[model samples]
Target chain A: MYDYSSRPSRLPLPVDERMASADIDLGQRKSIYRSLQELRQFEKRAHDLFLQNLVKGTTHLSLGMEAVAAGFGAAMRPDDYTFATYRGHAHALARGMEMGPAMAELLGRSNGVLGGKGGSMHLTDVSRGMMGSYAIIGAHLCIANGAAWSAQMRGSGQVTVCFFGDGTTNIGAFHEALNMAKVWQLPVVFVCENNLYMEYTPIDLITAVPHPAADRAASYGLESVIVDGNDPDAVYLAAGKAIGRAREGGGPALIEATTYRTGGHSRADPAKYRPLEEVEAWAQRDPIPMYHARLLGLGVAEGELSSIERDVAADVDAATEFAKAGEEPTGEALLTEVYADGSSRWRN
Target chain B: MAELTYREAVAAGIAQEMRRDPSLVMLGEDVAAAGGVFKTTVGLLDEFGPDRVRDTPISEQAILGAAMGASMTGVPVIAEIMFSDFLAVCWDMIANEIAKSRYMTDGQVSFPLVIRTANGGAARFGAQHSQSVENWAMMIPGLKVVAPSTPADTVALMAAAVRDPDPVIFFEHKSLFATKGEVPEVEVVGRLGEASIVREGSDATVAALALMVPRALEAADRLQQEEGISVEVIDVRSLVPLDTKTLLASVEKTSRLFTVEENPRLCGWGAELISIVGEEAFWNLDGPLVRITTPHIPLPAAASLEDLAIPSVDRIYETVKSSLR
Candidate 1:
């Protein structure tokens, strides 16, 4: 078990020193902390549900990567689009997807976001600008670039943020998309959530560069930045700048947020591939507890923090109940919606 | 009506659509300042400017992926893959992302994407450049496969493809680029899933696609004049949402079914049509279904070998004449 108390005595805070010196206000600071807690707690519940065999298919969790979601989500406008990888529940939640529909989707319920057709790997909330998630590594990069290109063509000023892992940077599509983005001056921010592990293998084993953003960004001519992903304030500050620049037609930027998954790659694996000390160290630096510590240091009351936690707990419980009660889709429903105009008339 | 070559009709159609809808963007290698390789998109950069008519790196995956992404955001994208043979390089984006987006999103998303690529073996472009992989696209459920045979149909169908709420694989034939035909002066949009009777006859029904449509027509004229066999030619414009109604009607009248395509004989576009006709109008046929296609060999670079590979007018004429017996 990890400690949740936000005490300065935890010594050498796992986060960057900049978090302590950042100019974030008390209210905004509290909100960021609360968002991380909510995401963390929600993900924990989802993992529990997966263990209980309620989640129909396997799900990739962002257990310790909540700050990246909370920070990036808070910075972007609701109208701004985001394309994320399969470990995308936090992104969808942060981008304003309702917990009921999101959880229902995991349970493969009829009321699920994608009507249960797309389970955990393919969560989409178009209205809130969570364009969709892709399971294929590096596939969504060009798609996000295209969305940004669309924004540029229409002069919408909507910045498209694409979230992928460190492993995805090595994929061919990633390089192609970044190159196209730079050449076209697309208004997009490519966020590589450098979680160290691409599934079982460490990213360094496969990736050619020391840092994905450092080497690849220069090649693509994209304005690049690196941030402590565990620190929400740092991510918010860096991501906000990148997104702002993109919205203002400064072209694309690469923000490599270095963090760790702190969980198994998927539902089945015990993650025997990783070292015990590495896992334990990542656990201690869990974003939720780290954020809690910062909130306490910033003068947040223990009771106030407890109240936010209680509300989040209640919300997640309600979501579970709603998902359990969701109806199972019929075979007839599957035939529908294959085509927009329902031109897949043969199925009918 | 104005006389326009098949290539001109495609360009005119795209330019007309781009003018009407500002969100329609074109992206491909050499499509912008240099115009397209075949010059089908000539003067588009001058008219629409670089942004709408843009050039892309030699990245088919990016071209398709970006086009799909753009389509999801309400911008209709027409991405030219240079040639249908190269579609294999970007098959994942087409088969996985573009084809499955709407279905996987449970209708929450729609990809108004048009993938325009030149199909068929002609001009000794060899195995790499020349291939009629229309059947590969036809097998994918979500895609709308269209191969226009005439300039008018090319202009009309190109309009429909751009406006479609789904992904459309528009296969343009390299051989028919300079083939002249009359196109409407006013803008016309060909309806998807509709077939055109290019040459009407009574003895046998020859359902053809792409480059084979002209050959089937030539064969029909020759058969009528020489052999006194009235051959009905059906231009299978849309392969995915196939115009089975017109095909069945034609087959019912002619009482014989023949499919002409430049795709390989084994498991080609003809194979699917044969099955469909066998299932639906099998009892109505006067004889067995005939499929004329390129031999199942990689198109050789040599002209003599290529001639032996691709189906010719002589082959179609002889087949129809022999089938009548």
Candidate 2:
């Protein structure tokens, strides 16, 4: 039902929102938009690199998912741990893993995250506390729960955020982890980016229940919120509330951010299998342009947006060049990382 | 030297370690109140209090998972997974998380964690709980796997496991719990990469672990008396960082070798022993080193069948005598 071309026309741009705030005059909103553009552009490069590196692989680009990462990413401090799913490109980019190395990782270059070994799904940057992205669906929730419990035990005031899709809710591990989190009052933020599709299947056809994320939260007696994920500002505001409540020992919070995967499930599909009308409708509510229009509405020149775009493009270009040029890791690397000390037992 | 049962020696090892280092803690089902299913932790709660000696929920995953967490945060924790067979529930936490944490973290983290579990089918605990899982430890990376055959070896190796900056699976044979022996009063940490030579001979090398160590020694004693075949018994206390030097050195002296283990033969811990013998001491081997193990079947509950299931003294001696021929 939403108009596709004029999605940004629906609301004030993020730049405009900065102007509209009652008394605050900080350029945080503009900073968020600028930082987000960096995330999307780099991720786009990484996606292409991933496609090139992997033989017959699937890669999910977070083109419409940037705002979610930026919002929650900027809101939290560094020591907090984050567990993300396969659709975690933006989250990694947002968490400050240098663009070049991460891009190299996608390209399977020696310069990548695991010296270009883990590829996209296994990208890990421990300095950022982005515990390695999990390949198994819903299993990461238990790891995140354990990480949060560790934080609670350490008195580090460290918060844990677990990012998964609507499909993860159907898993038994997800339910068990959520129940444990609520019962133990672990300071965890369960971020459900309900992008309306699990992979190819629509949320409705796949799940038995409605409001698949938030409805399940109440069963465990944990507080939850439903937010407009398309709007980064809304996500940031909601995350701020939820993260604050969790850090204060208010148990755990389940945040359902309603959005859509504008791109098809993976690199392969043209998404021709999807009903065209439904796809068109979701595109109309696309997050990028609406925020752009909002920015222009607040007396921001078109040149400012272009400048941000230019910077992002340049960043992505440099990352791609860097990844492409990185030296190939030696065959010895395969022998390495099997253990901390790299025991020579397997070696001849 | 203070006299104690084999169970009491284990308790003393835990108590001494806890007293020696403030960071050590123990968690198992009923470890605090009932003092372990084997009563190995008896009077520990009274001495150490509730926090240090914990009675965890009947969740094996959580028990091992918490120990991994505590270890990561700079404590050396020893957790008991009630029965070695129950370890199947938390195998992921052990193999993937605890065992792999150090290596996966690129040496950023050190998991100085020890897991103590009792294994073997000597008591007829049935197929579900009686299987020897030394092979499971062999499968996991970043873990030092050891099974102590004697009370002295158990005390020493456990102490070494706690002190080592790696995840160590300390397996104690259930049948060996009440079996008393001369354990040293002041424990000396045994070298991990060295195989202890229990008995010396010339004809063959007998390698074993846990209760099988004594059984192999017993088999060697019998082989000498019956056939005048002197077998050198080598206790392979740890399997992961296998003492290839000492083992091969003994194998070099005695061209023939036999392995006796309580576990099943298929992809079993005995396979690794065979492989090692095939590789390192290949030219030295007069013939194939035979592996004496339980037949590949679920251990039966009947006592007579259970005795047949495990490698007996005569069985090991027969295997060794046959290998010599």
Candidate 3:
């Protein structure tokens, strides 16, 4: 049985050590490093847009946690299903969603992927296989399990990637979904973004165990692995193996990616709960700069790295212009798609 | 036409849909080898094989979540929660994910799924096991709610629920499972929002649903015998897209309305029906609208206490008599 009571002293996240000796090829390393840098820039731009009152409602920007999103998104097939949390802009971007429509969605424009209705919390594009972003904390686990089950039923060899936070593991649905996934051997990879804090509460404050993925795997009798989420190579390697195992019918796996949240839980939170020293320490291990250093060490020229940054900046600028010029849905379109078969009583 | 029990009708409805649509799959606790605790899925495994008829763990969230994902992907799914009360465990999926997916996705996806669960009281099962929450589903805009009192209606409505392009909550009353009624030998599919005037009279309109339909008919018989009062019993089978036209026509002829429901008195389906009648046909009403429902308390496990807690033939009769008076 896993011990629940003894609290261990704080330890440095594994990515800190893993980044020093990341054994990735030049081509793969450059690609992974550039992807992390682009995601970071995208989120930072989103933050700036929020500050400028351009992005409406709330955008849960994944400021410091770009490597896990890049790594997991890179490892999965284009047809693989991705069920994401509300802080899913990076996940969507990593899964090949164009920055223009994604930014347009945050702006609640008619040209958005969800036609402006979903805003930030519910971004979906089934054709691209990003099933959607569910705002409810732990609710998508079973639904993603169902997606895996459906693929099994249809003989469609599709794998589902369900992303959630560490706080989600405390929910009853998390236990229920994990147990079912284990029993049924569903083809799903549960990716827990263990950024330490679930909103304001730290993992140790709410959970008995220190590692949520390993603890939950032991409870559900499912296979589990942990990785340094700040290292794109670590996330890519672990998720690649997990997704391959699931696709080959080895059943579901849990991956606990230990990273840190640099931004507030949401748009309005100032993140006063995080200690200044801890934030400063995590800032030293920022995934973007760490990967940038690794790419330079791997013989990628400084000029090429700067070109990647400049290109991403231009891309973010173009995305903003697209969203600002996009249309908003009229009142007539309010009742248009309430029912797939148009059976809503809103229709005359 | 052939006679069948409510259990057989429900099973046949599911089996027929499975046969017609290869993509239709059923999953729930004990629905496979056990054929369901209520035998609602009896002989389904043998006919459809284990792939189509699956036995799930006792996880309501997984059941609903999997059903939502499966339906959105391709196949039409039927997720049978063993009891209607278990819906509370998976209410978020039904209300948030399943019901809202199609609309929230802007019609990019369809949730072709049915949540079939057994409800109602009188078997001494306590409050947790026995509940009539069809009204809770009725309040959701994207969902369709169906309750069948008789086996024939069960066959047609079950088929309709499976065929519906949206999520449907099919509430089957526990007490009515063994009740026999005549159904067609061939397949029957009833449109969801249509109501049936099971019995016709002229004095007052008694709108009842699910298990209350038979009791309402019995009360109508007693009222005709005792006080020469004629009552039209309207089975409001579809609660969400309610057959308000048929109900209002019945109310127009009768000039009085008495709604009977087995759920709690406050905010019940009866209140919605009465409100619709009051709003649309208040000038035709000859008496105040009356609602017959259970008291607002959890049901006890004793037969006497359960009987006292819920609506019954006697309660329906008294409420109707007073409404007519």
Please give, for every candidate in the order listed, the TM-score of chain B alone compared with the true chain B.
Answer: 0.98, 0.97, 0.99
The DockQ assigned to candidate 3 is: 0.63
Best-matching candidate per DockQ: 3
lDDT of 3 by residue, B127-238 (tens): 8998888878888878889999999999899899888887889999999999998999898988888989989999999999988999999999999999899999999999
lDDT of 2 by residue, A1-348 (tens): 432322222221222244244232336667667768887777666566656654225677777777788878877778877778777778877777788887776766777777755667766677897775666566667667766766775677888888988888897667767776776688889899888777766676668777789888889897667877877777778787788887888878899888777677778756554566666666766777876776676677899888989988988888888888887778866555554456535211
| Residue runs of model 3 more than 4 Å from their true location after superposition | A1-11, A14-28, A346-348
lDDT of 2 by residue, B268-290 (tens): 87788778779877999788878
Ranking by TM-score: 1, 3, 2
Question: Which tens-of-lDDT digit does each residue in A23-135 have in candidate 1?
Answer: 87788777777688778878899899988989867989998899899999888987999999899999999998999999999999998998888899999999999999999
Q: What TM-score would every model get versus the actual structure? A: 0.96, 0.87, 0.95
DockQ of each: 0.60, 0.24, 0.63
Q: What residue runs in model 1 are displaced by over 4 Å at the alpha carbon?
A: A1-14, A346-348
lDDT of 1 by residue, B86-178 (tens): 999899898888888787778889998899999888789999999889999988878988999889999999999988888999999998999
Clashes of each: 0, 7, 0
Better of 1 and 2 by lDDT: 1
